[model samples]
Each structure stands twice: as structure tokens, then as C-alpha cells.
Target: MKRFDEIDEHNYSSDLIDEMFKLITPEAQAKTHYRMGLAAKIDDALKAKGWKNQDLAKALNIKSSSLVSKWLSGTHNFTVDTLVLIQMALGIQLLDVGEEDKPNATSPDNGNTPNAPVELAKNIDAIKQSLTSVANSNQKSFATINYK
Candidate 1:
């Protein structure tokens, strides 16, 4: 008995419904996909190499196996230090710590390509130099203002 608007009608269609579901779903995101893939690869590698969770824990210098388990779960937001340790232990380069893989990298949600590496590096260096200059200027200003 009620007349639906165009937006409401579009929302009820199966295709639109599926799209909406994907947009709202965590697993549908690219970052989640990348992380899950990485986790599976790590899991397979560990099994293939006969390395146990305890072994990884010991190698990372973590006392508890639970922490290692958490790392392998793909849900834990690992620190850079932990990621480096894992890379060394597994001998697998999951992330490109260097300049590679920059151009093709995308925003996690929309998959937009990242900015050029050279430009990004230049901007970062400029910011660093500016901050250092500002700090030096501040120190000089304080010294000049000191009466004693």
C-alpha cells in the first residue's frame, strides 16, 4: 500500500542488497583480504617448515605461546618490531619495508592508488627539515631572550 521512493526501491533489489552487504561487511574489504592471505601463507609456511607456535614465541623472545597465536590470527595489529621479527624468523617478506610496493598500494576501502614515491619521500624530508629548523629557531629565540 505504501509507495517506495527510488532510493528505497534501489535498496531492495537483490544486486543492490548484495552490494550493500559487501560494503557493510568486514571481510569484503581489501585490507582484510590482504591480511587474511598473508596469514594463510604464514600458516602454510609454518606447517611446511615444521615450526610450532612455541618455536615462533621463543624466536620472538615472547614468553607465552598465546602471544604467538594472537600474531598468527590475522586479527592482532602487530607492531613494526614484531613484523620485522616475523620476517626474519619466517624468511618471508610479507611487507615491503623499503620503497618497493608503493605505487600499486591502495587505500584500504576504495582501492585508490597511492601517491608517487619520490614525491612522498620529498615531502617527508621537507617536513623533517622544517621541524628541525623550527626547533633550532626556537632554541635560539629562548637563548636570546634569556637575560642571565
Candidate 2:
């Protein structure tokens, strides 16, 4: 067995250990986890659409296959713009926010039907945000959406 000093030369024999080391920073760990989550979502979407990396890149107007390869590698730190573009182009949601991220729903996927109040409030909030965005884009004045 190699001594601890030998292993301390910034090298590790185990791939798992190496990966763990890469996640030593809290920020890096969170970012890596998020990246992997998005990567898994992208992988599922590709499989569902029967698309190769080239197909998605072409659809997203991304000319570089290498960039797509990096995205699929589960290590790419995607920008919000890139994520938004991908979601808009593919029509597949990769990130869940607000009520969408909440587990409570009124159906098999949504919140429980018995608990309508919570779900209703969430739906209203989502609609309000949509309306606000639409109204703003149309140069119409509207009340800002408040969490309350």
C-alpha cells in the first residue's frame, strides 16, 4: 500500500475520491450538483426525442458539437441564458421554480387534490407572474407580483 505522503501529492488512485476532492468547495459542490442535475434532465430529453448531440446543437443554433459534448459530460456550468435558450428551443423544462418545484400538487404529478387551497394559491401566483411578464412586454402597466 502507498503511504499517505505518497497519496498526498495531489493525486488519487480512485476516481470516486478524485471526484470527491473536486467537490471540496461548498460553492463548487452546489454548482456541480446543479450541473449534474441539468445534465441528467438533458440526457433524458435527448433520449425521449431520439436526438444526438448534433441534433440538439443544431436546434439551439449552437454550431459547436464540442460544447454540446461538454454539456452532456455533466461538468459544464450552464449560464441562465443558455438554459433559457435550451428550454425555449426544446420546449422541455430543465429547471423547476416556485410552485413547479413544490412537491405538493393536485394530481399524480401535481399536489394532492384534497389540498386545493395551497395548490390554488400556487397556480394563481404562477399566472400572476405570467401576466406581469406579458403586460410588461406589451408596455402595459400592471401591479407587480408579490409573494404575499
Candidate 3:
């Protein structure tokens, strides 16, 4: 038997952790990814608005800023109402629920088709900003979308 102090650093194998991660279902992984992505977006919006954790808490009517921190940690499962409240407070769209799908010429996945679903865009904000800049400018707008 090897004592904890006696064990070398190389004695531990990360394969067990890798196998444990492999046990997670694709749906579970996707859910986690979306949650973490949403949390990141929230953090970005907060920074853009120059708001602190306490400010967000105040906006959400939450008494504890710690709870807001938990929400930003990406582990918290957010309720729809809470999400709506957050969206309202931050002036950002957290979720596009119950909206009809519109094919965007800006998206490469849709291939300018009206019927194709616009795959979730990672750079939608950047694209929008660029488009806005082009619109404001007299130059012709040419957008290049790279979707993963």
C-alpha cells in the first residue's frame, strides 16, 4: 500500500477522470455547455454595462450578491422567470424562446435558404456590429460568417 506522502506525482492517472467524462451523455454535455455559455454571455453583458455583482443583484431584486455570483459561476440552473428578469435587467436577450425562425443571409449554415434553420451563431453580436458599421458607412456590406 502506498501512503499519500510516499506516492509520486506520476502515480496518479488522468485516464480515470477522462473515462468519467466520457460517461456523460451528449445531451448532458450540451446542456452544460449551453449553461456555461449563457453564464459567460451574462458576464460579458455585465462588464459592457459597467455593472457590478451588487448592481445585478439589485436589478434582480436579489438580497444577496453571492447568489448572483453563483449564477455567474455557470453551475446554477436558471429558471425561465429568472432568466427573463436577467434579460430585462441587463437589456440583453438571454434566450430566444417562441420566436419564429428567420433564415439569415448572414449565416453560412443556412446557405441563404428561407426554410433552413439558422444554427446557433457564436459570433452573432460581432456580425451585427459589423453590419451596423457597414450600414452606417457608404461602402457596400459584405459579411463573412464562419460557423463551427
Candidate 4:
């Protein structure tokens, strides 16, 4: 149970640090997943308590329905303070990001696995190409439309 701060930085290998960075840098995405799981738990609790979104919003002191809507939609990038508020409001812990639940928990695919990094890179490149194609198409569509 070594804390991140307790890690021996002087002895740290670049490869090890890079792997750690890959795991830690995706925290926003991990938090999004955790929030979604928490939301599902809260929805279940609300159903049991016969409470609605407005009720939870009122408890949280959030005025707008849109605020709650954004939270439920998982599109909002919540700050640490806001996450604490939501935890208090919902009475459930939402900090677990399912890192242990990864399919390749023993060895990550980012050059840590035998052939997984190659496959991962190929998949990522394909996704990037698809996204770029979609973006280019959208840009062309926008350019052709004259908004005078």
C-alpha cells in the first residue's frame, strides 16, 4: 500500500513512469465512469425512497433542472469539490474508478503486454482516421453553406 508520493522518484524508471502516466492520465474518463455508476446507484436509491430528481436537486441546493440533467447525462466535467457535494447529496461513495476491473489488469497493453500494444495502436489509428474523416466531411458541409 505505497502512496504515489511515497514512490522513490530517484529510482523510477522512465518506462515504469510512462505506464503509470498512461493509467493516471485517463482519470477524467475513469471519473466519468465512476459518476455514471454512482448515478445509477442514486437512481435506485431514489426509486426506493420515492424521491425524484427535483428532490435530490433541492437536497443538493442545486437550483436548475439543467444542472441535474447535465450530471445525469455524464457530460459534465465535475470538479473535486462538486464530486464531494454529490457524494454528500446522494449518500453514496462514487470514488471507485474500477481500475481493478480492467480485463488486462495483470498487464496493460501499452507495450507492457506481448503483442497488445501493436493491436491497441492499430485500433487507435483506425479510430483517429475515422474521426478525421467525419470532421473533414462536416467542415466541407459547413463551408458549402453560405450564412449571409
lDDT of 4 at 131: 100
Candidate 1 vs candidate 4: the lDDT winner is 1
Candidate 1 lDDT at 49 equals: 79
**Residue clash pairs of candidate 3:** none
Query: On residues 1-148, what C-alpha lDDT tens digit does candidate 3 reach at each position?
Result: 7778887877676788989988987556656766787788799999999999999999888899998899899888999999899999999888766655654222334435322112333356678989889787744433344446
Cα lDDT of all candidates, in order?
0.68, 0.72, 0.75, 0.67
lDDT of 2 by residue, 29-76 (tens): 545655776887787888888988898899988888788889988899
Alpha carbon lDDT at 135, candidate 2: 76
Better of 3 and 4 by TM-score: 3
Q: Please list the Cα RMSD from the true structure of every candidate, rounded to 1 decimal place.
A: 12.9, 15.8, 16.0, 18.5
What does the lDDT come to for candidate 3?
0.75
Count of clashes in candidate 4? 0
Residues 19-85, model 4: lDDT tens digits: 7767853445445645565566667666777878888789888787667777776566678787787
Of candidates 4 and 2, the better by TM-score = 2
Best by TM-score: 3
Deviation in Å, model 2, residue 81 alpha carbon: 1.2
lDDT (10s digit) by residue, model 1, range 7-125: 56644557776778666544335445565656766777688779999987887788898987776787766677876788788887666667564543333333243333344567789
- Candidate 1 has which clashing residue pairs, if any? none
Between candidates 2 and 4, name the one with more favorable lDDT: 2
Q: Quick one: how many clashes does candidate 2 have?
A: 6
TM-score of 3: 0.59
How many clashing residue pairs appear in each of the predictions shown? Answer: 0, 6, 0, 0
Top candidate on lDDT is: 3
